[model samples]
Target: MPEKKQKKRPGGMDLDQKAYQGIRQMLFFNEILPGQKIKYQDLADKIGVSITPVIHALKRLEFKNVVSHAPNRGYFVNETSLKEITEIYDTRLLLEVSLVPEIIRHLDAESMDRLGKAFDAYREAVKEENYYNRLMTDMRFHLTIASMAQCQIQLKILQELFDTLLLKYTRNLILLGIMDSSLDEHVHIVKSLTDRDMDGLRQALSTHLDHVRNHITDGFRKMFAVKPRQMVDLFSLQ
Candidate 1:
């Protein structure tokens, strides 16, 4: 029906792309905070959709380890342990840095064209008022380059890291009012990749990851500093 077709997907997206956009936006903005209790029906209402689509979206998010279902408690955002986050970034630095050569070697005219378009979309997202769109566009641009390289295993690693680290960094960036910087980093990474500057790519990726790691680390410290100090007396007994 025309009415069904016209229905906006959760997160202000068209019905066809609604589910994808909804999850992508949610992850990108860290809208679903870590350890926050979530109910499917409630999330559905918040997004202005139904429980069916939300369930579908949550299933997809589970693959990325972004959300988990607990018996009796329903669904909730996954908490990222500091140690786990460190391990994720370590693997990311190793896997993605190794991807530079493969991507450069397989680089072709058409692939570069597609990369350019994705990068442009990221730029447009930055200019737009929609934070959700900016996040989705940013992911599209990076994933496009990764796909062009055609490395399945590496793609999996990047995908995992993207889900794990995105919220941590996204939340920090938002708190710092530097959401635009996230978009800028995507453009910088794409530029390095487009130029076939392996060294540039290496440096870009390193800086990008380092910035993310620092952001999360700093955020954790800021958020939990007082709570950790509260444990000092308990640790003193040991």
Candidate 2:
């Protein structure tokens, strides 16, 4: 049977949310590449939604730095930048490392269970051989650790950072062959958590993130070297 290309909507999902997830799926599948100017009608047509919801979704994405807006230029997908992504990594390290103590302090049976399950999910997801699944499970694993800190603001910031980093650099993740080492790093993190070793936890996380950051930034250097501000349509190129 041929697989359906259309997205299935969850019950009770509003158009705005459906549009958001639809666009995100496009991004994950590489249907929407960076440096592409997103047309509201085109996005809406792809998602089977009205232009209004796509506009709202793009506005939200603009706030996350996933897209950029201009006075009359509509929205263009932001190209990857080594400098900006490196800053994101440094900022994330500062925030996540600082939250280690609180994560440890607030550790309880429920939290520990969540962390363990999240790790397990990531480990098992690797076997599924789906990039999007791996990316999402990998993200959930880290976010699970941060969620234990009980800090909503930092958690939100971290989520947005992950969103930008993972989505914008999806190409790097696919080509870097970094996921091979990620499971081992995730295991080290879980071990530190189980032992309640704050310093060790920080080390594991720092090393893991640093490795990912380095690989991605290195991979994207060539990308930025020739990156166009906006990707023009093939039809327009003529």
Candidate 3:
């Protein structure tokens, strides 16, 4: 019998994936802000794809809790409440603090060098005012430390938590002048790790997370304050 060749799949999947990533970046970079409604045609136009793929991409985002779809109102970005944000930060502190000891046990010269490089990249991003790159590199720096613990389950959970928290909040904080202090806090963390000062590392990590919680909560309160509605006369002429 002759060997049968496998049929090639249509390129629709590729387009769908591309659209998914495009919309995700839009969300991550705040091109589409939280609590804002979005139209499929608008997303299709922005992403340079047909409406079908945009719909599929949004469905995927909806599955990830990145967006919510309403029957008649279309899709809206998922909004994180102050209470939810506080709970997330609290959970993060517990997971990351527990991982610190494991990270210390697994640290080697190569790991330290990698951490240095990640830190350097983040600093460069900060200097260049590249908010998107800074956010990514900052995640990398922290994830690198988490990976040192060699616990896949813990790392995966932490990554998901970080993603959910960062999607809408961290960019606002960076814009509000929190990056400089965050970088300083990271420096203290790295120094503690380098010196194998376990107590110092715990304290530094706790302080850093506390600062993060404070900055984000404060920023949200100021940014999301309700404004008084302006009364408009229906028959007014300009």
Per-model root-mean-square deviation over C-alphas: 8.3, 7.8, 6.4
Shift of residue 204 alpha carbon in model 1, Å: 2.4
TM-score of each: 0.61, 0.81, 0.80
Better of 2 and 3 by TM-score: 2
- What's model 3's lDDT at 94? 86
* True lDDT of residue 55, candidate 3: 86
Worst 10 residues of 2 by lDDT: 229-238
Model number with the top lDDT: 2
The TM-score between candidate 2 and the true structure equals 0.81
lDDT of 2 by residue, 25-85 (tens): 7886678888898989988888889998898888888888888997788888897677887
Write candidate 3's Cα lDDT for 98-215 as tens digits.
9888888988999999999999998898898877678778889888888888889999998987777666665554554344588899999999999988889889989988887787
Best by TM-score: 2
Q: What lDDT score is found at residue 129 in candidate 3?
A: 81
Model 1: per-residue Cα lDDT over 94-203, one tens digit each: 77777888888888999999988988887886777555566557667767877777899889878867766665455533343234357667767878876889899888
The Cα RMSD of model 2 versus the native structure comes to 7.8
- Could you tell me how far off, in angstroms, the CA of residue 194 lies in candidate 3 after the best superposition? 1.3
Q: Would you list the rank order by lDDT, best first? A: 2, 3, 1
